[model samples]
Target: RKGITKVTVEALPAEACRVTFELKRPWRWTPGCHVHAYLPAYSLWSSHPFSIAWAESKPKAQPLEIEMEKIASKNGSLSHSADIDHRPNIVTADSTYSRKSMLGAPTVTTISEVAHRKDGVNIAIPRDSAVTSVSLIMRARTGMTRKLYEKASASKTGTLTTWGAIEGPYGGHDSMTSYGTVILFAGGVGITHCVGFVHHLMLQYQAGTSSTQKILLVWSVPNTEALEWVRVWMDQILRMDGRRDVLRIQLFITKPRHRGEVISNTGSVQMFPGRCNPETILKREMAERIGAMGVTVCGPGPFADGVRGAARSVVTEGVVDFIEEAFTY
Candidate 1:
């Protein structure tokens, strides 16, 4: 059994909640994995599978910026203090910083550049990382999920704590890093399954270990409030190095109350009102695909089926692979 550190009730009207589990020791799993959560307090014999929305290690005393500066100094790549002030903020597995300094700063060196070889094409060393915590987002429907939600809602703190156990970070063996172009389709809580993949791909892309050159995440949510489910994780991803060059996000709000609710943050990440047509989006992406493309979907049955059919319609035009995520209870 593990300790349920915190449970946060999201701002969504659908009664969605995020549960965080603190592991006894470090655990590692690939992207797109899940855990069977057994919350005995809520259900003695019942356990539910939840896709991992985020995972990370416990923070250490030493800051990443100081560590990177030490490494850069060792390699004779450390810049003057004035120049260092203008460098883009670096993000690690457990922390995040601003990326605004990257704009039009030609002389500002990045952590990647400081750690690169003389040839400027290879990373000097592998990143030291581990996972000591796992989090899951669930939309309260029935049974244990509903019970958990109700208890948290009644609490004055708007959070809940209980004993929990998890088994097998399983079924993430499939890899998408080999594809040159990849698109992820998520609906509602399905965003949990795709967020890890995007984070992994971004890390690999920064490390020069992945073949993926382009990534597009197409998510459909009932309202703008649903975006809060992954807002923190997305912020970390957006701050990663080279994120703007390879990643794009398109969000579709199926039931927006007003035009003001649908606002695009930037060119790379845009928001629109109403449902998104899978066929049209798929065809448009296929037209501009760089090389072999991969399409993945994790959503309700009808939404997954629509994405599947759309992918099938374009298989003859290019090398396309389709993956659908589902769980059998």
Candidate 2:
């Protein structure tokens, strides 16, 4: 059994909660992996499968903020780096981080500084820095999920602590590292499945260990508040080395309370209103694909079906492979 360090429930109307566990021993898992969580306090015999959202090791000597600032200052602008030639031509939204003209030197700004200056959210430790803790984002439904959420909600601190056990770092059979271009589709809480892949691919791209040249994450959610589910993990990815050169995120808000609610945070990361058309998004990415492409989707039945259909439509076009995540219980 592991120690459940904390359970953080999101504000009301959003039933999702983040559960963090402290492992007795180090465990390694690839992106797109999951574990069957058994929280005896909530459900004695029942265990629910959840995607591993984030993992970390014990911090080293220096503070994470200090490390982030140092890396940011050293890396400077995203564009105009020495390894720019190795990256594909990705269309980025216009922002203060946009690159200057070829004749002029682009302004230098660290991602860490921009994150703090605009969002007032401090970028925490890197997601891959260590492996002592694992976190999962669970959307409250019936059964154990509901009980955990209810207990945490009733707590004075909006968090609950208990004992839990995790079995089998299962799934994650498909690896996108070999593909030259990868596109991940996530719907609602399914973002948990795709977040780990993005983190893994980014680290591989920086280390020159993988063949991936481009990664596009397309996520569809009900409202802007849904973004909170993966906000902390996303911040760590945003700070990773070569993140801007390799990773592009497109967030589609299916329901919006106001026009002002949907706003793009950076040039590479953008937010849009209305649902995304998988076929259109697939075709657009295929037009600029670097090499062999791999596509994966994790979401509701209808959403996963749409992505599968889109992938099937383009099977005759070029080298493409599709994978869908499903839990049978």
Candidate 3:
């Protein structure tokens, strides 16, 4: 569980949204985990899951950061979300699913932040204006999730469950380190999860690992807004290839395609959206070409479903290596 302090809006290019949050740091969190916040001020204790986009404080002078989203009011609460001056019945927190919250916000705990001053060991990362990607620190609270949900808006505590855990920074999958060309499938925020994947592979190539791994990122975004936050990530990926040939990204716009603009014109990504069909996957031809071909995905509900369906069929065909990190399984 976590608490929200300062909230801000961050941008990528043409899109903007309520993006950042100040979370209390030194709290144990993994790059892939999400903090479920409880807003008691809103008579709500349910944790709104958010990936730990980034965190600092290690090498000193570093600040911790968290990415948040404010959508078009879901539960008949427009003013509540808009009024960020800290309103009553408006407590913003993560799902109360921690050992502390479940056992009842502990008076003490240790979370992610700076390393330590004891052995003079600390990570040295330069400060930059780049929010490359958003990450989440998750909780594995499977007890009375139903009760926690019900008691939030209403009074009756039903039974519910959230089975997850706190993981470290996502350096990406073990497969990314392998040689050979790689075809990547990322749906939604799945793109963010791949920062480590792309970076590590590129680094390996630069280090002369002898394993020239080519990558194709097929991304399906939720809307134009989501793309904005991701544009920075895209821009950097673009520069990683001096010859501009490091990674190939094929982005699909599933829900919002406007005015014949399949994708934004910066050459940031190749665009298309809609469910990722088996046909699309088939066209990629990984199934027919054997020898070290792998497929991976990260995205929203439908995109995830599409990936599973298409990839399931491909795996059965026994030609491609399908790797997945299920957000909810």
Candidate 4:
């Protein structure tokens, strides 16, 4: 069913935005799954897939409460919360992007330099509400994503609440609860896929529903600003019951804006400078072997390949399984 974009916040790092939408109907999905969004406003035939970031625990009569610090704006103009790039690009005068072709056959303009094929939008919906709401964190790439960014930039409040449709809560089926040690690796916005698994597994471990005892979430990003992408959700996960007992998060920032941005908390949550070496991390994880280890990765092709390679190199070690999430359309 169609969902209404209720709130949109220009997330930090200048390349992304956090959007909230209220679904017309109620739906439940596994944490690591995703949803496809078809924006009729852009083009009906072109649908984008996004992971489900956060969801409501139980149905609620009230809308999900979103608590984010409002970004300042001057004269009610597009606030800092909105990062709009008004730079005009050279589009072929051909009918490629024309309304006729968009209707007859979906075609999108490709800008090689600035274009990054977005995996999909991630959503967090409230439970029990007559109208369910979801928050989507999007990075402006090319075509539809660029259009969405421009539209929001043109908004006075920097909000891009609009009419859109969602399809399927796909691919969260792999259950890691049977394993004793679970390691998740995420890159950039790929963190959306792993966030739900962390939440679900923590709850399962806390309630003693499954055998999972150790969950190590390793997230790699470009800079500190990129960290803002999942800050809100991470804050919530940190407070979950027995979270400290089962979760260990290692954040890797390849580029730091300044030396001060490279702070580490030591044990539970630690921040490191530069990229991570999969082999080193995997070997260390093996040294502290808990039980059977399940390694899952959701990120760029290179990162996924690296994780797979590392896991394969150590197959001789106890029970180690590797799962990779690839939503290639």
TM-scores for candidates 1 onward, in order:
0.77, 0.77, 0.51, 0.74
lDDT of 4 by residue, 1-329 (tens): 55544444453345776765566666665667778877777766788888877665324353222211122233465454567544434432221111122565433222111122221222232221222655566777888777787777677776656677777767877768889999999988888878878877876775688799889999998876666667766655665657767888888988776565576634677778899888889999998868999999988899989999999988898899998887345
Cα lDDT of all candidates, in order?
0.76, 0.75, 0.43, 0.69
Worst 10 residues of 4 by lDDT: 110-119
Best by lDDT: 1
Error of 1 at 209 (Å): 0.5
Ranking by TM-score: 1, 2, 4, 3
User: Mind giving the per-residue lDDT tens digits that candidate 2 earns over 1-329?
Assistant: 34444333343337878887677776666678788887888899788899888776643344355455566578884433435333333532223222223345433222221332223222222333436667888898889888888888887878767777787678877768999999999999999889888888877786788899999999999986677677767766776667778899888989877675565656788878899999999999999998999999999999999999999988888999999887334
TM-score of 2: 0.77
Alpha-carbon runs more than 4 Å astray in model 4: 1-12, 57-131, 153-156
**Cα RMSD (Å) between model 2 and the true structure?**
12.5
